[model samples]
Target: MATLAPQAPWAMRLVTDRRPIGPPSYAAVTLDASTQRARYTDTAGQVVKMGEHGTNQTNPTTSMSGGGDGAEPQPQTADDSTPDYSSD
Candidate 1:
């Protein structure tokens, strides 16, 4: 998912087609500076034409503050060979 701009008349966010079917039709895409990854969208009104694209856009400061990716964090593993001295 991507946001049009951090702040602007259209600060709308969008979910991109990660796996586009055929050749890309020059769908307006933007690169999120914070993530260093490009964000796109197949939904209309979200994407724009070339040259009409915006720049210097970034993710909202609180984009992920509400909650993480919604995935639980993985637990750290212990050294199988090491004994549990703490129990003693």
Candidate 2:
């Protein structure tokens, strides 16, 4: 007889309650799993569930993008006398 593995639970819901106050237009949110629930805290730090929550995978990529002109920094050459502190 073979034993079956346990099934995984449903994904959590990502809730966006309100818009962020600072720059970079972010949202105040919370993630509530199927087996567990999460509460959002207000400006006064009171926990409450005010907005609708849903299960949605936002970004699939977990890696950071190469920012700043989208160009990799050129490696220093041996002829460059910037300073070879490696000898120290």
Candidate 3:
């Protein structure tokens, strides 16, 4: 149940050569367990699917709630520091 995020602007993608390469990447890309899918989109709008979120006893879920890890998502608020462009 580890979430990997880009501290700088880089994301490593293992290419055919089996080497990790990335720079000037994303701010954050979370590997969510809700849908049991691992996917991420970078600053260049490239969607990458690594793998699926496997099942584990540490993160049990009810059948009714789907395959979520039973952890509630934290609420996120809009960044008021940024300027609004509704007029535009």
Candidate 4:
């Protein structure tokens, strides 16, 4: 008489569909530098505009200090600089 063997593990398979959904739609926006404003447009060429720099027009300057350690010294001679050589 023959003996029965153990069954192998089962695995799931993926399914795919191929079809065209509908007409393609496009969305875009434009930035106007003359007025410093932004304009948005939809697929049908309808534009929605917005303005910027309402109150805070100028950018603030930020100061960054050196590390607590003292500044490094500058070299004087060409020998102190990096050595350069021609490679043929």
The prediction achieving the highest lDDT against the true structure is 4
Worst 10 residues of 2 by lDDT: 79-88
Task: State in Å the error of residue 84, model 3.
Answer: 60
The best candidate by TM-score is 4
- By lDDT, the better pick of 2 and 4 is 4
Predicted structure 2, TM vs. truth? 0.19
lDDT of each: 0.50, 0.48, 0.51, 0.53
- lDDT (tens digit, per residue) of candidate 4 on 31-77: 77898766577777777554443543343344433443448644433
RMSD of 2: 20.2
Can you give the TM-score per candidate against the true fold?
Answer: 0.21, 0.19, 0.20, 0.24
The better candidate by TM-score, 2 or 3, is: 3
Q: Ranking by TM-score, best first?
A: 4, 1, 3, 2
lDDT of 2 by residue, 1-88 (tens): 9998875554423445586677422234455576466556665655665555555433332333333453676543343223222221
lDDT-better candidate, 1 vs 4? 4
Q: What is the C-alpha RMSD of each candidate to the true structure, in Å?
A: 23.9, 20.2, 23.5, 17.7
Residue 1 displacement in candidate 3 (angstroms): 56
The order of the candidates by lDDT, greatest first, is 4, 3, 1, 2
Give stretches of model 1 more than 4 Å off.
Answer: 1-26, 43-88
TM-score of 1: 0.21
Ten consecutive residues with minimal summed lDDT in candidate 4? Answer: 75-84
Candidate 3 on 1-88: residue-level lDDT in tens? 9998756434434334566777734544766689875557776657765555564333233233223345775444433343323321
